[model samples]
Target chain A: MDLDFTPGEDTFRAEARAWLAAHVPATALPSLETAEGFAAHRDWERELSGARWSVVSWPEEYGGRGASILRWLVFEEEYYAANAPGRVSQNGINLLAPTLFEHGTDEQRARILPAMASGATIWAQAWSEPEAGSDLASLRSTATRADGGWLLNGQKTWSSRAAFADRAFGLFRSDPAADRPHRGLTYLMFALDAPGVTVRPIGRLDGKPAFAELFLDDVFVPDEDIIGAPGQGWRVAMSTAGNERGLTLRSPGRFLAAADRLTALWRERADPHDTALRDRVADAVIGARAYRLFTFTNASRLAEGGDIGAESSLNKVFWSELDIRLHETALDLLGSDGELADGDDGGGWAEGYVFSLAGPIYAGTNEIQRDIIAERLLGLPKGRR
Target chain B: MRFLLDAEQTAFVRTLDQLLAAADTPAVVRAWSAGDHGPGRALWERLAGTGVFALAVPEEYDGLGPLPVELAAAFVELGRHAVPGPLAETIAVCALLRGLGDRGPAKEWLPRIASGEVLVTLAPAGSYALDADAADAVFHVVADGLALATGHGPVRASLDPARRLARPTGGEPLMSGPAVRDAVREAADWASFATAAQSLGTGLALVEQTVAYVKQRTQFGTAIGGFQAVKHQLANALLGLEFARPLLYGAAVALAGGSPGAGRDIAAAKVACGEAAYAAARTALQLHGAIGYTAEYDLSLWIGKATALRTAWGTPAECRARVLAG
Candidate 1:
């Protein structure tokens, strides 16, 4: 099969390369978990929106360039190659945005998408409760019918970006009388600052308030905030989870860029030929390249009108593991400085290493992903609960 | 950019799979290991009749064009059956002969190889020559050129009895100089690339076999496949094979397209496939428990081949170094 980009795609790459070269910040933004860093990243998102670089795959009416998946991949390559800041609006743009486009009504789409794209409303996902992390179907959150709306009552822990987010979206049991674990659930969006809502920030492994505990006590949500049909929240939320695991949420460009930095670090080290470390560095690079090719294949399939399927679980497991290995190799090469969060040389491998530890746990745990692969892809018998 | 096999390539692989299935590969492998190469030879002739042996031979040599992708596709099926021969090395030798450019030995050997009248095997500079005892000719690869073996020396048994390695003595310098050196390097890449493909094929075979076994074999009043631990282990092995398969195909494309990163890409494929296959072997044997360890069981053919191929063209460490070096 052909691996060369088309002329039009090459032109898109050139344009992306040129824009990224001119627009990437000279200095890295601070950690997005902090207030100052969050504001800075939010401003950066607005800047990207101003240039219509915020979402290249969205339709033109949704403030995107209507770029095909291949072009979007090219855009991602250039985006990460330039070492641009991570998207602070990922929850809104990557996860919830797809759901909104797929399941939201015209009124909700028109009301929420532009603001979300412009970074005027940063979104967080409230999927997991303290007792319902991997077993999301066991969530006890409820949405009781109110006057012309629903009243949400639940506590969601480990809601990423909720510490500083303006809005949150999640699934709630709308029909309490339903028997099935996943039945009668409804997906809803609500302002985090509503009257009965309270957000207590949860400190991450790096001691940053990147996630939070979201408590809702009879919080009122308008009828228009419902996404898809009530009692079909399970189906709607599955779409968002698919996006989380697919090429949209975690692009290969992120790993490619990390690989380049890791290679450079290895090349610059005193013993560039350390046998053990060299093998690992090579593995990281190979893993990254494999992932890049894999994404391109997926992009090609999508371009041919193929649906995104269970393969995203495969991608999630691979990249999350690759992230840890690349970071681990970099830390090993750093030697003494690796243990320090901030060295005199300004290295932050320690912080990154800690962050990488969460990759296998987030989105969906690797254990759950493995089960999905076995039961779905391999046609293996379902494991007993 | 498309990274998948086209319709023709897909059909080619499907046809090869059907052919291998009809060949009763397990019986052939069993016969071959008992020191009877008759069944293996018949299977080779059948494959040759299908132009499998001629894929990498040049057109002028009365064969198919030197197509690396086609060779990769063929070898994957050969590997899936754990075919008992140096097929990868033979195809690589064909490419080297075609690439030797109008030399006397090239003309003399090309036709014989294309017709499947003679078998060829190769040993890289530092590796033992596989199938040397059975091959009509052996190419002793050197850094600067190839030294053709006039006679095979003593054969040594390997962990996989189906694969026999030998020392090639009486090396007569066949080709030398820069072009030949480049040809040798390209041949090595093809060799590594084919090994990777074979590893992936064998890995898939192991997983498939284990999947069938776990579904039927009951333990503690239930099929072990229903256990979470067993399911997770098998799933992880499947992940390894699935991820590595694309890399193998991508490396095939890169080599065919003459990409600048072809060397590193091939090496990357080699390492990924090697590790993936090894992981599959481990899980298969572990899940199969005692049966997987027995030599009489058919599972040993794939398990042994997986271990042997993991270090064939290059060890995973060596392949990894090549990746980093590039």
Candidate 2:
């Protein structure tokens, strides 16, 4: 397999590098937890959209360069390596946008995508509930048919970015008459500011309102907002879940950049006595590099027209675990200073370590991921209920 | 650019899988452990006929291709089947001969090796010579260069009985120039890369075997594979094995590409494969219960092999140091 980028890809990388060097904010953008920080992140997304850097992989008609997956990966490498602000529009751009492209009608795409791309309408995933987590099919959220639209009633917890998002997308039980557990589920999108909708921010371990509980009481969601046919939400949401596991949601560039930073940190504090720590540090780098190479293989396969299936579960299990280990190693390197929350004194390590904890829990817990890997990837017998 | 194997490479792997599948690898391994190298030797001849041994030899030397990536590919299958021989050492020796360019010694051994006329194994400077008694030629690896040793001292028993190691008794210095230094380094890297691939293959075998076993082996009137704990353990083992695979393949790519990070990548692959295979061995044995520990059981072969190969080329500590140095 060829590892070197082609001339076109290299040129794209050069262009991306040049643009990021000139435009990326020298200082970190404000955190997306607070109101001010959330607005600042949205503004950053707008700036990226203005420069057409927000969605390089999207089609030109959708305000992107229509770059290949390889170019998108290159863009990501440059983006993360530059330590630019995290994408505040990721829930819209990565998770929902793809579903919209695959399942939405032409009219829906024309009306929704440009706004989502421009960061005018931030999106949050309303998937998991307090009752329905790893077993998403057991969700109690319901949507009853109305005159022209549907009346939605649901409580979606752990909705990331819902605290400040403009809209929410998820599955609703649309046909109560269906006998099967997963039957009659329909994917729907609704504005968070719609009447009878409420978003209550949930404080995270880092004391940030990064996620929220979305409560919907007869929220009117138009028929046009339903992604794909009713009673087929499970199939549609599975695609979004795959995106959550694969490159779109968790790009290898993020881990690689963190690895580079970890190596740099090790170089500064290189001590021969801590052989255990050194080996662990090396392992962390190895895990990150392995992930980068693994993604390249996946991207190459996709380029060759291969479908990504349960293998995404393996990726999710690996990277989520590695992210936690990488951050934990950084904290170990910082010693007592790792607990500090101050901006200085390497407190970012503490913040990162805490955030890494959510990796396994979100996008499907590692436990659920393991089950998928076992049952689907390994072709094992179904686990007894 | 493609990072996964192309069509030809995929076909090559499939061919090797077919051959190994029909070879009764466990019986060959058992016979080799009993010092009956006949079956193992026959398998080696078949592998050579497939040009597995010649994949890394120079094209001019009657070889199909001359890339460490090919060697890595073949060795993964060899490891999967627990192919008994110094297959990795033979390929690495071929790489060393190629690295020596068109020198007289390389020309003398290159064609023979490519045609499977001679069997070569390596002893890296301070380590014992592997397959010393059976080897047609043994390369005495020094810090600076290599010497052709014709004799070997007392054979030492290996944890994995299929492999026999001994001290080199006599050495005839074959190469020692500056170019030879680079060749020696290339040889070391090949050894590490090949060994890593083997570990990956072995881990995969163990995971597959264990998954099959857990599906049938039941407890409390339910298959153990249905148990969440068993499922998670096997999944974790598979995760380790799967993740290590990219590192092994990437190491091949880096070495073939001659990237500046080749050494570090190879070392990283070595550590990752070594650890992953060892973890798989642990999981396999634990999940298999007492049956896995039995000598008569086939799982014992892979278990012993994984334990031995994990530290064969270099210990995890040494590989980590090489990685950290880069």
Candidate 3:
């Protein structure tokens, strides 16, 4: 019920604010999906790792302060408010790392985490296939035994950042004849530059290679690279999916920063007579604040040893849609100039609008998130999956 | 930096919920809507026995509070039961009296209010006093001040039959000045905060009732809840309601902390929670199809109450303006 940050937390916020103010780039980097932008963001991530700010909540042995989630939240708020760089290592730090922390071996953690934290090796998700978007359990990707490793061969489409990422992780059907579609799968990580691996960058609506398709042909993945036990991929992957849908993937601070920028945009460019747009601007701010407050509550629960399960679906539906609305409000304020590629400084409102278009579709579509919320959270009768 | 309710607040909410659960609130609501306040008044006294109304009055006044968090939680339960009365108005009036500081008026009325011996309501300068005929005292709310006004006109029907509004006139200014202006603003914020909590509670009820309905009311050979279309709409409604919750509690926290920006936080909560509740009402009605339209159905009481609470303290447009102004 209390909302006051502790003195230590206040000091932490001050330290974070100072560090971000000093180190964040003077100008925004290019979109991470682009080649040059990808490299620049990787450098930014390295700098963050140098300061141990890249993963503040991880144990210190793994290059983090082992900060509490509350501290992590404060750091995020500071990071975003300072207009810091977009996280290039998020697929590793946010999605994969949590699963790793849960299921990866100590060897895996010691080896993979520091590199991932330093952005020496960026990671991408290879979960979806052309035929397995929402129904991902039905994916046809397979992995079979090899002399010293597992050989993977299948196609994974809509692999985010695979165009430039160093490695990718996904579930492979290790025992294809298992009774259930979700069973018998194994989660594995493979280097994208392996001899039998190919990445085909696909252009998004704005003609950017925001995501890519992957073709794996006997790409050798070591047995040690597997996450969790064999045939338990479904459970392990669900944890990653939970992290992706919940707090880490889209922190409330990001939206709060966007909301602030949207308000600034409105104050600068909006027509005086546009009351409708004015109300919408206000709503976007409120929505962002609500999301931030909501996440704080969830983090508090987590701090108290509570788990966020199906409720993550609610977060997925909320923040993704709120991101879209906040961006849309900015575009509405921009009016005709919203179409320009770099209208709001180098932040790229038009590009952001185009990117926000994917919010509902990614990290599992909003439709699927809604179904999860309904059946699991609300106790609604299970419908067709 | 915790945002979940404390044990005391949780216990208070649970008590209020159990009391309302056994109060036969639907019967009280129907009786009040039909212009019979006997049952509703009795329900209010029983709720008062739980120290519900006393949560708003300051501790110096033989009451437990100015405890905004506890009060908000209690009002949520009241709204969940569709309790028909000026629930927010009474709390807001107590806030206004507290904002006036140590005064004869606060001492005189605060004890009666906390004990449920009197039902007091207030009306903005041009607006109407809710439940005018039932109120023992009506405070007139001006732009920057307040008064113990009298001479209430006949009760006028609102969209909510139980929410009978009447214009109270012949004001006797009890407070005026810069401090009163701040007090007046505080009163509005409290009203809006509590109303938003009520709105959220109402929405939760609507969605819960609808969830139960869709599970049983079958069509086309299966439970309609089995349809993706129905499930998605309810999910969206639940999303709105769930996210709105933290904002409401956050506003309560801001108020408890005496933060200067509590007004802005309250307005933000008012807009978000109120809209979420209203949207839930729309979804509830649409999902229930024709059956939800009947006034006889218990759901209609919540349906009507949600809309009333939305504009009771501050309309969406006004609240949004407050938020943007900050």
Candidate 4:
């Protein structure tokens, strides 16, 4: 396969890079801590949307530039190179938008797509129950039939962005008479401000509440809130999960920016005499490059409307592991300062390192990705369950 | 720029795969391993006649023109077959000579290299210090000036029996100055890429052989491949190959395109391929049971080639150090 971008795509990249340089402010970049940081990150997302630069591969009607995947990749590369803030609406832009496009009704699309495109509303996923981390099908969240709608009751832990999100989409057991647990599932969406819903921030080891625990007791979801059908929650959930597993979570531009920062950091701080550390930095740079190529390949395929299948699992694992390793290399280079916290006496390597530990845990654990590769890609037999 | 292979390159890859498949089967590898150098001279002659060596050489240099990525893709198939010989080295030498703009030796040597009449190996391993007694010629690049060892005495050195390693005995100076340093570094980079490509092939072959053996060999009335431990090990070997393949291809492309990032890419590819090939070979040997330990089996030969190639251009640690230094 070829790795070179086309001339047209290169021009697009240059244009995108120029725009980012002109418009993306230095102060808008996000730190891993602080609500203000996330707010600035969201503001940048809106800025990108306003420039018609966000979601470059989305259809023109959906506020995208209707660019080719190669162009989209170029845009992403330039965006990351610009060190733009993380997209605050990434969960919606990456996961829910695709789902809505595929499964949402006309009115639903009319209402949600624009808001998502403009970054007017933030979305979060309420998927994992406390008892059903990897075993997602065992989710005990229940939804009962009610007057012209449904009443929901469940607790979703690790609900990333739940505390700040305007809305959440998740699966609920909707049919009490269904024999199979999966058969009773239904996909539902609700405002986070629904009367019976409560969001509790969960402070991670990194001392950031990037995730929350959502408790739902008789939360009302209108009939229109059901994405597909009464018994279609599993399918809808799978669609979202597939998107999450594949393209939505990954951003090549983002990692490239990190790689650039990492390279500059190493060049400035690392002693060339410490050959081992130098080598590790070299590896990190290479990994970042490879990761970008891999993502770009998949992006092109997606643009061509081709299915990525189990390969995205492999990509997810590669990038997550690479990000963790790159940050670890940074920490190693920092030596004593690596242990300092964000507000501590030293620099923020300690905080970055702590946050990096989540790379393998969030999205989906690397272990789970391996299992997917083995079972789905390699045709290996499923584990005991 | 596109990341997918263009039509011509795809066709080139298909042709290379077909040629390797027909000519470099496991049986052929077994026979070659049974013989010296792990490749028949006639087979080498056939490949040379196909202009494989001239791929990276400039057309004016009596070469097929530059196609580093094409050469890389072809090597992947060669790696798949575990074909043993110095295909990578010859191509690398052609590229190196081309980079040096010294077509005289290339014009003299490339046709012979293409015809499988002569074999050349680069001596970058002991670049810092040259032994003047063993090599027919020495190409040296340093900050002060470049020098060639001439009219030196013979010397002994330990080398992999499968491939020859010689010290400088004597030769006239080819080229010297700061300009040659770029060429020298480019040559080193090409050599690293070649080693990485060959190691990838060796590792892939090891995985294939190991997987096949595990599937056929049975324990407790069940095939060992059916065992989770066996499956996991085979999977791990496959993982190593997977992780290395893209990096190798990326480096090849970078070098082929003559990108500013070539050095870092080559270093990364060398480290990844070296580690992957070594680990895969070890696991493959371990999974082959007792037969893997025996010379009768080709696994040992593949293992030797992998080990030799891993350390041939540069050690993994050295490559990694160079990459980080950038």
On lDDT, the leading prediction is 3
CAPRI level of candidate 1: medium
lDDT of 1 by residue, B1-326 (tens): 77777789889889989999888898998887766778888788778888887787777777886776787787778888898888879877876876776467777887778777887899888578988877778898766778988776677888888888877777767677888877787887788888998999999999999989998999899988888898889888988888887788888888778798988888899999989998999999999999999998999999999998999887898898888785
lDDT accuracy of residue B137 in candidate 1: 83
- Report, to 2 decimal places, the DockQ of model 3: 0.87
Over A73-115, each residue of candidate 1 has an lDDT whose tens digit, in order, gives 8899899989898888999998899999999999988889888
Residue pairs in candidate 2 whose N, alpha carbon or C atoms collide under 3 angstroms: none
Q: Write the per-residue lDDT of candidate 4 for residues B1-326, one digit (tens) a residue.
A: 45555678778767766777787455555554344433455565666666667676666656676776777766766666666555555665666576665656667766665556665544553342222321233444334334454443333332223443444434445676665666677777787887788788788878777766876787787766666666666566666667677777787677776688888788788888878888888888788878998866667777777777788777888787767554
**Each prediction's TM-score versus the true structure:** 0.97, 0.97, 0.98, 0.87
Q: For residues B194-271, could you state the per-residue lDDT of candidate 2 as single tens digits?
A: 899898888889998999999999899988998888888889998998899889889888878778998899999999
Where model 4 places Cα greater than 4 Å from the true spot, the runs are A1-11, A22-25, A28-40, A175-184, A300-305, A343-348, A383-385, B22-39, B99-103, B125-161, B164-182, B213-240, B286-291, B324-326
Q: How close to the true structure is residue A161 of candidate 3, measured as C-alpha lDDT?
A: 90
Candidate 1 regions off by >4 Å?
Answer: A343-346, B142-144
Fnat values, one per model, are: 0.82, 0.83, 0.93, 0.36
In candidate 1, list every pair of residues with a backbone clash. none
Model 3's chain B yields a TM-score of: 0.97
**What 10-residue stretch in candidate 4 chain A is worst by lDDT?**
A342-351
Residue-wise C-alpha lDDT for candidate 2, range A79-98, written one tens digit per residue: 99988887889999999999
TM-score of candidate 4 restricted to chain B? 0.84
Off-target runs (Cα >4 Å) in candidate 2 are B142-145
Off by over 4 Å in 3: A342-347, B142-145
Clash number by candidate, in order:
0, 0, 1, 24
Please report the interface RMSD of model 3 to 1 decimal.
0.9
* Residue A385 C-alpha lDDT in model 3: 59
